[model samples]
Target chain A: MALASETPRPRTWWRRNQQRLTPWLFLAPGMAMFVFYVIYPIIASFRLSLYDYDGLSAPEWLGLANYAELWTDPAFTTSLYNNVLWLVLYLLAVPAGLFIAIFLNQAVMGIRIYKSLFFFPFVISQVVVGLMFAWFYAPNFGLLYNVIEYFTGKGVAILADPDLATYGIIAAGLWPQIAYVMILYLTGLNNVAPDQVEAARLDGAKGWKMLWYVILPQLRPATFIAVVVTVIGALRSFDLVSIMTNGGPFGSTRVLSYYMYEQALSEYGYRMGYGAAIAVVLFAIMMVFISGFIWKMVRDERGVH
Target chain B: MLHLRTGAYAALAVLLGTTAMAQQRTLNYYADFDPAPLAAFEAAIADFEAANPDIDVVLQNFDHEGYKTAIRNFLTTDAPDLANWYAGNRMAPFVAAGQFMDVSDVWADNGLDQSLGSALASMTIDGKQWGVPYTYYQWGIYYNKDVYAQVGVEVPATWDAFVANCEKFSAAGIDCLTTGTSALWPGAGIFDYLNLRTNGYEHHMKLTGGEIPWTDDSVRATFAEWAKVQPHITENHAAIDWQDAATLLVQGKAANYVMGNFAVAVFKEGGMTDETLGFMPFPTINPDVARAEEAPTDTIHIPAGAKNVEDAKKFLAFIAQADTQTKLNMALGQLPINAGSTVGDDPFIKAGFELLSTTPGGIAQFFDRDAPAEMAKIGMEGFQQFMVQPDQLDAILERLEAARSRIYK
Candidate 1:
């Protein structure tokens, strides 16, 4: 009994409560902010989606009229197509970033400066990025036009042409997005287990095979983060649309977010209900991707044990 | 000396008491114009303060885009005493809800029609005057004289002449036209012009109001007509800023531009010599369409809850007078709404007023202002897209029809 009393327990009573209480405490601040700003508004918007509120009238309960209208809306359809295009093309940022990060991972004098300069676009405001791209693509006066004219004998104003305008805007959007993913990969590469990499190298693995078989498997967290950011960035592509074309060259650039603005807040009309419905539809589409991500995360969490 | 001091104290007490009363019953007045109108309004409000000495007028200013949305939202929030709003179908939905105060009584009491002309019609909804008309502007053609002169193209007055002029400019490698179409917003006038010419004013109104279907022959013909002049416009105009288009005209990069008269400032800012600048109505498309050629009046309004409604009405009355309109118009280089208000010494203003007075027929409001916003956006984008690629008409119209069906329904 004396020896038992003298011995130290691995966990105290406080430690027994820690696993249960610590997570809640750590989560409290983020949870509070998330519930207040993000979750509550989403529920509020879903509630708002059911009403025929002009934002001026007392919100009238209109059942699913807003949702019904969405099915028939060509504007909604156009925006949906553009959004799909954005999502698909935005994935290029990940691979492009990875490639750039690999190229940048060289031992040279002033390499740090080169990396920061490469990542500079990401730090700049999207508005500034958009403006720079607009100037860069301006028909007769832009740098791209000068290059194209030198090569092709015809300078195409990319933003002014309907067939190419969305792509042009998307390209502008990708400039910074690629940089962001590159920085993520750079960080991931910095944390890469050199011992494991050296062991894999001793087995005569290198280049694409080396990256694929060894390096990338260790880059799981960075890739996951990069994917999350890219998906979110693609969906929230309003600034570039607003600045570059404003969903113009005939509404061809209208993404879901911009179309929602066009529907609700624009001089076009105060169709808050219609806009809310569009938002809900977009939210639903995002939720699909989100569920997949969450499922993967849950599996990873279980694997951690 | 004591008697004089007593008298001074009495007057001071009265002034303080009046100011205190005004503080309690202050009314907020909102507007969207620049400082000139606001300055004039504040000056008038001072006069109002000296007169009523109780009801204070709080002046609020918003940018034009913000004003449009704010007015719509104000029906839910703290509405201003008075505000500036557009006329036509733009005002219809709001007026339908009886959200705006009916100023017909004040309007009639002022004998507004005698002085204001049909300009008041812009503000009328369902035969009721909902707000007091304050300031309005004309929309028409603003052009570069040096470019026209260099290209040897006269400002076309007739339909045949306009097309020929466009052909000449195109042959000369000069872009004959320019306007903004980037947002499918403010720069939708070209589509409105084609519709106005093809079916005349009534059909233009009907089509824009969602009363006529998009598949209507009148609308089709309008699209057909615009497709003819597609090549004459500046290359990459869809990407050009309207202000920059005016800049282009001023810089001799383009020959002509169709926009509101407010662009006169932009031309001057571009360093175009005043003699090099010229203004005219849009050339007739059908010749028999009875085109006013000139768009009409800049607008101002009193919102739903004005504290100094009586004073505001008085100020509106004062502004409506021929002399005051002339003074304000001359100061701003805009054409005065009142008939007898003579154009000032500014050559462009003189030419603009000359076009307005000499032009025979009804003045139609520009598309974005005249057509409800949704139709305006769709119509403009479709027209612009179609102009760039003519083969898209059927698809454009189908999409428009889908949009129209939703909006109209």
Candidate 2:
């Protein structure tokens, strides 16, 4: 008792609390980074949305004027509409990926080679993919243009037409996105229980029935991941739009992400507050999905515990 | 003890070096120049250093496109002593934000009023000179002479004749006018020429300066003029780049291209000799309107936060000198802004010099330079849209009018 009393008080406190504090100490660096890089910027973007800033001049408090302008801005509407189109069209990757994964699942001659070939698009850079698709859709001497010209009397330039340009870019984005989804589903398929498949077969479940009842349930984790990634990917679709059309043929191809960049940072753009407002709207939209995801994840984690 | 001795020596060296640097003032200059022009500027810098032995000029080169975005950041955060930018309304935002230094004293002390008289109006804002222009290039119709000869068309001297030639060229299975509007600025060249030809320089300036409404009939007249040639502009032009359009002109698929003088290099590279490539002033639209020309001037300015203001002014004065501009522009293959500067012997250069120097109405900067950036962007898109769908002219004009009201205010 005399020895315990003689020991330093802070040292005893540290020894007593070390177990509870250890994990937090380990987490401190990463948490600090997240707060600084991610949380801080998001809060700052929210604050900036209420101001009018040209980046060169001091930011003036405008009190939601930028947001009000977004409602009236035609470009903002077009961008929002295109973003919806991208989200709906981009979701097509999941089923298409599942189909490809199933088709390529069988063991055949050089199956690995075929699988690798199928996975190749996702492995290449988005910029290169965008460039390739751009060339393919280019008018006059492009291969697709020539083919179309041969079929019809007049050639159609996909990117030149405002009505078709967004769809064309989305199609380009899907080429690699489908491949990415396929790889995820392939891994998920590998983990399916053979005993369950056998049991289902015994119960007269086959083909469509087998997949719907047994295979899909087992693939839920992969499907969840694929959907999450695709949602994020669709929202942040900037590079392909930048490389392919630069949101052009009269701003018809602008998605929300690209429009935000155009308003704040592009050669003609220095409207910081306006860009931040757009960013805020985008963040609010993203939060809906993210919160839904987090809610589900938390409930599932609780169930597991 | 040995480590302490080494640390002491290092500190001594740094102290001596800093004192030495302090004796010779350093002027940091940021410029965006292509390879050839960079070499020319380097040579000019060498001469400047030789002339002013006490000053050191350190030039940091940036990529052309990246420099536009970078300048905004650096000007506010870490400004250089000197930086390169465009003249007219292109510099207005920077000038208004107090990012650029007012260099009226530099112009006054150097007598630039007489020497660089051609660029005086463009360099001035709020009745004060903000920068010194070094080089400018003319915008006009660059054509394929071989295609014109094959199609049995004469070089048009008037807008009516030009439209007439367009029909003949289109009948001959060649595009009359070819411009790639994918980047959008190329279409602005066409608009600038059309507006200048239709309403003269004063009206064009007023239109770009936000004094005139886009819904005005005068602006509509320019679009009506544009509509005359719209059908004959190359199909799928919105998908192709300027270089690709140049290729079309080279291959005789397009007869004419409304472009700046810099496209000559692309034409030459595509195997078109000087004999086959031709330059003509944009044809007359209205006989009553005085002939104006588009010559976009590129200038350099000292940043407001510059440390070496005196030396920076000296550098600007040196750049404005006739001999310096002549040599610089010779290497740039562009026309010098200084009135006393001599142009090179290139045929295109000579043609541009003659065309600009003899203009009766005035010299106007290109559309993107003349108008505020947001207006320029929206206007160019509207122009591109008009080229695609002439029926949307009313809607496009309304949109532009809306933008102008918001932006200018």
**Highest-scoring model, lDDT:** 2
Against the true two-chain complex, what DockQ does each candidate achieve? 0.56, 0.88
List runs of model 2 lying over 4 Å from the truth: A1-11, B1-22
lDDT of 2 by residue, A187-233 (tens): 99999999999999999999898889899999999999999999999
lDDT of 1 by residue, B1-409 (tens): 0011133565674467566564545555667767666565555556556665655555556776677777776654666666667667677677766677777776688677766665766767777777655445666677778778888877888767877888988887777887766655444677766676667877877777788888877788877777777778877878867776676687677787877767887888888767888777667777677775536445555656555666666555665667677766666667777776777787767776776666556566777767767777777887777767788788988878877876776
- Superposition TM-score, candidate 2 onto the true structure: 0.96
> DockQ score of candidate 2?
0.88
- Stretches of model 1 off by over 4 angstroms after superposition: A1-36, A58-61, B1-25, B35-55, B185-187, B294-296, B306-308
Please give the CA lDDT of all the candidate structures.
0.77, 0.93
Looking at candidate 2, what TM-score does chain B attain? 0.95
